[model samples]
Target chain A: MTRVVARVIVTPKPVVNDPQGITVKQGLATLGFREVEDVRVGKYIEVSMEAESMHEARERVDAMCRQLLANHIIEDFHFEVDQVLHRDTHR
Target chain B: MTRVVARVIVTPKPVVNDPQGITVKQGLATLGFREVEDVRVGKYIEVSMEAESMHEARERVDAMCRQLLANHIIEDFHFEVDQVLHRDTHR
Candidate 1:
């Protein structure tokens, strides 16, 4: 079996409000980083698994995101099939 | 002034425990994605603002990461200075 690693990123839809991002921006301002104009927070998921081929891996990951990883109503989701390599260890 | 947009990604150090990731993996398994071997969760931040120049933008962003965006003790952070463009609106 090939080791397939992928990344799924979830972010709030532009039309939706992000309290966390606003809070973080406020925090940055308190820390004296007033130059920062805007900030939006998101989730980055790294997945490692076995797959028959890259095609299958991409298909499965897309399904996983739709079924479980992201909330389609309020959030936007995207992913990349990064690698089908051996013994990768970068965290 | 140049408007520089940057992205900072912060993930737990490999040695650190990620309870959220573990929970998400369990959730995925419950949803029938048993082949997923491991999952690590991280933060993705999109920042938009003005900067004097590209070089200064990168430097300031690096400092911002070290200062407030990431907890360096338990998290590993990296970023890319994506664009120094004008009137960008993609979130």
Candidate 2:
């Protein structure tokens, strides 16, 4: 099996209300950061999985995101999958 | 001024408690994501700053993290600073 890394970014769609993100942006502005713009808050999850191939890993990671990591009603998730060397199989 | 980007990853120190991360890990396991391990949850803040230089940008980003983005009592933050092409100066 090959070790794969999936980096998932879960964010509320643009149309959706994100008070948390808005609040953060406002806070930045209050802190004298006027040049800052387009602040959107999201979840970043990095999952390392052992799968036979990239396709299988992507499918499994997608399932994991749908079932656990993200709420489809308010959030959308995007991921990038990469193969990594298995430095420590014993751990 | 130059436009710079800072990617900050904030996570609880290893010795600190992370109940939320632990709960999420358990949830993933319950969903049959058996390969998942060592789940650490944190905030990823991407800041776009217009500063006189890279050193100034880093200082401002560091201050932002200390004042608002991170709770130093429980979390540690690491950031990567980059320069991005400004395609829309008007916007």
Give candidate 2 regions above 4 Å deviation. Answer: A1-5, A53-55, A80-91, B86-91
The lowest-lDDT stretch of 10 consecutive residues in candidate 2 chain A is: A82-91
What fraction of the true Cα-Cα contacts (under 8 Å, chains A to B) does candidate 1 also have? 0.88
Clashing pairs in 2: none
TM-score of each: 0.94, 0.76
On residues A1-91, what C-alpha lDDT tens digit does candidate 1 reach at each position? Answer: 6788888889999989999999988988898778888899999999998888888999999999999889999889888886655586674
Q: What's model 2's lDDT at B79?
A: 83
Q: List all candidate RMSDs to the true structure.
A: 1.3, 3.7
DockQ-based class of model 1: high
Candidate 2 residue B71 C-alpha distance from true site, Å = 1.4
RMSD of model 2 against the true structure: 3.7
